[model samples]
Target: MMKRARQDAMVENAAPQTSQENKKQKTCFYGSAFSESDPHGSIDWGSLPHHVILRIFQCLPLVDRARASSVCRRWNEVFHIPDLWRRFEFELNQPATSYLKSTHPDLIQQIIKRHADHLQYVSFKVDSSTESAEAACNILSQLVNCSIKTLGLISTAKPSFMNVSKAHFASALTVVFVNSKSLSSIKIDDTPVDDPSLKVLVANNSDTLKLLKMSSCPHVSPAGVLCVADQCHGLKELALNYYILSDELLLALSSEKHVDLEHLRIDVVSENPGQVEFHTIKKQSWDAFVKHSPKVNIVMYFFLYEDEFDAFFREETPVTHLYFGRAVSKAMLGRIGLNCPRLIELVVCANGLQPLDDELIQIAQRCKNLTAMGLGECEVTCRGFIEFVKVCGGRLTQLSIMEEVLIPDNDYSLDRLHLEVSKHLGRMWFPDMMPTWMQFDAKVTKTLQVKCGIYT
Candidate 1:
């Protein structure tokens, strides 16, 4: 009888302990179960679902994500997820001077070792330091097994890639060019990427290549670009310096075998303004291209001086977008108004003190498809600007006129300028007032240079 009573007491004590343990396992630290809510709280963080942890890790930066993995074994698994490694920008910079926090070398190595093959859209953004460019090249060379679809080598400032040895840079670039068979888009502006590397790119990715932007690559010649045009029949978008543009390349692109080009950007830069004479694209060649790709957008960025523009806009051209980076002459603007009928967008960085009232009116009259216009250091009377808007009417989607561009006249002062302009635009419109701080901020100026295609 004594033994039986003791056994009943032991069973009663064990039952409550088991119940408490079960409750603790069911509830989370935040008073909720992984799958559902629980009233009796708390479980450890490790009990959370794998997907939830992966999602949180996705939002974190590379460094933070790596650090977070140390918190638990489950998070470490999430860190190795292939999806997280697909699109990554390798920010290479010198640690001492760069404002941007450089990616950890160990982490880069780890990524290359484990997840290089998983990367698809990859870009290397380096600062002005040659060390950073070299580091970027080293990383590029190691991506031999990567099947990247899009690759971009961007210099934060001052074409740092130029500082890298040409042989080294080309060799490193060819590693990806040879390996990534499905590369469709590449932006390698302001680099030392030569013709041979470009040929390698065409040989490997000719079938899949769609967009190629290599403006400011001084080493590529017209023949090199022609090679690409001939081989990469599926190329839809192309951007290169004016030096590489030629009648032969245009004819090749206009060939029936080639796909209808969607966009073509040419940077007309004058290293020695008066010394360099630009060759004109024959009207016949331009006609063929226009006929072949009726809806193609031909964008031209001119960084030439006043007199160097004589060869351009002398004949009928199909240039849809025109950007003048330097101070263009009044005569040049007049010529553009006459020749450029298909003009869709125009950005004039500087046009001297002469009021462009006649030219503005002429553009509104001639360019039927004109939709966007940006004027920086230019002149236009308030009446002339309002009249120009009135002529273009609701079709003018983007009209970015600096406040100073419009000189207040008797017909319209600064106060009533917006009202009259708004009436013509069919919506409220105001002149862009440049912030005083933007004048001193180099970063902002750089951004404007990119967006507006202004040189300085």
Candidate 2:
């Protein structure tokens, strides 16, 4: 009986030991479950050096960065790093488009709310819709404190972002102009940006601004542009419509204090076809402008009626790169040969069937520096072409003349003309030939035709 009592006591002691072992087993199981459930705790990616991780994140596109943020807690934290958000492009596309994917509004808001301070360079590109414009405005308005250095607003639509009311567009843009005091490059074409907004831009960014392109902003007058010219003497390049040009503005640009301008693009728009009276700059005025900035590139795009050519080249004009949108006349081309002494590039789309023999020869003789020429729907005899090539020589770096433009006269020999021009161009050309599929065929079609007694 005494041995049985001792045995029963031993059994009770062993039961407590068993309970302790079970508790240890439960603790081990819970630890492994926690490790599996908490992915960040299990993965070693978070242990990567912060800078290395940052570079990897930087290479990912803005859209992909948002997706990677949901991967784990550590990645979510990295997504918020300021460096990743410095240069952002807010591309807005319609709901169904193949060109680009539209940015989610919620994500845009998240960026503006959390990382707007990190933005330095920004661009907004939208398709043809008011909704997209309004979305852009919303983002711009939210950038009340953004100090961006470069800003570009582009519209891929027909009506363009300018379709938005002036008041609305200016209100949003003013927010940026008022805040971004360090802006250097600003491009706002076909927007409703006016003089008041321009004043704000100049007041804020005059010292830092280097390039400005505000073409098709009708509300901006000559005085408005002049204000910018006088205030922003550091501007290297400026593009605007012709109406914004005046003697005062040109004189301001020519001032010694103003840095020698590098590029000046003028878009000549004719809204009313019947209106014959258009603005004209004097010959001496251009001479003075060129004298101050000799190396300046003067680009002119003409969108005028055939009758409107009377005032354009009445006297020697200072146009370096000239493009004709209408069917130019021989007389106008003759005037160009005499007036455009500084012409370097010329593109003519259409002229009648009458061969431009004299005009081509005159241009070849006069425009010594002409390096590039493109002709379409025009005619030039083989003799005239050969003469043009002789005068211009191999220096014509860019020559785009259609096959139809070469007229066959008494001096016509396509093979001979091709040989001469090709030798100078250092390339092969069949001046009389047009491209078709049979040119590269492997079969000996000519031999076969001869064997069958067939002639082309």
Candidate 3:
């Protein structure tokens, strides 16, 4: 009788101890044990407000945010918030050479299945692999319910989209064009997007389309772009190749029904040096465009040889920003000074072995709006450069001249050239020296190689 009573007493004492241990374990916050002495020991992380948890998830990266969703049912609910999926970039890359981590296939499927309707801004960044491009297309085709507002397909290296089947690419692109009825911006450079795809885009998103950049798209003819301009009256920015830019297209854009164009970027690329002949745009057509959009910025990027510049700068051209990726001759610079009075910025990557003394002075005298200039591999005497700067006199906002471009003369030596130029410009300046490593890089020859698709 005595032993049975003692055993019952021990069992009763151990029951409450076990219950207290369970209570302490329940006080843990997200797997972290908290002591009773800590002030936040009694706090419950799962009880946090939905918006506060959402704000925390918004600052995390895509992968991290997805992993955090599995913490609890409440956190998973916050993960499904529509606002979190508004702007997202799908980094589609190959594993062999790419340093960037590719988006998980499972995550992409979840996004398409759950949050397709919430995506407003989306972009796909792919590498120079056909597999990656195909993956992007596969994902694009599955976005059947997406209401995307802005879309961009970017290639990190040489265009891989061109390597895919044109029909396949067009079919996938048409899916987005037809489905996303409210698209405002699109940048599909170096793709195989054809005329039919562009037409579908115009048909679906004519009123909402504001910016369209389709440079280096060979399949798209001049008529295709004109169709967009005729229908999409809200287009404010456009970028295309020079081959597709015709007088008729300019006229269409300058029509009263079209909105005032804000930016126009033309890439003049010559695959064959002297064999390719360029057609000229009439001054009357250019004048009409200026009348319609006076404040428009007309940017031209030239990747043509010296002989291929015959059709340009012949008559009065209203180019505001000009970039020459090849070795421009002194004669062409002189013509630019004479014909281009509205010039604001000029970048000459390479030039012939001619001292551009008179050409520089003539440009300063004529181009009153000139504010920025960059000379890379060109010859300009120290005295002539000083005289040019004196004429502009504090109006030059950015002047990037290479050290090798300035030749020492009797009037100005290397040491004294900057001092004199600084006095005229009302600020200190120095000649840009070529870095030793940059000399071996091909990018030094063409600054627009990546963005504008103008390679040397």
User: Candidate 1, TM-score vs. the true structure?
Assistant: 0.88
Clashing residue pairs for model 3: none
> lDDT tens string, model 3, 63-137?
899999999999999999999999999999988858899999998989999998899999999999999999999
Query: What lDDT does each candidate get?
Result: 0.87, 0.79, 0.88
- TM, every model: 0.88, 0.81, 0.89
Q: RMSD (Cα, Å) of candidate 2?
A: 13.9
Residue 226 in candidate 2, Cα distance off native in Å:
0.9
Q: Model 1: residues >4 Å from true position, as ranges?
A: 1-43, 435-456
- Tell me the deviation in Å of residue 363 in model 1: 0.4
Model 3 C-alpha RMSD vs. true structure (Å) is 8.4
For candidate 3, the lDDT comes to 0.88
Name the regions of candidate 2 deviating beyond 4 angstroms. 1-47, 96-100, 426-456
Q: Which model is ahead, 1 or 3, in terms of lDDT?
A: 3
Q: Compare the candidates by lDDT and give the number of the best one.
A: 3
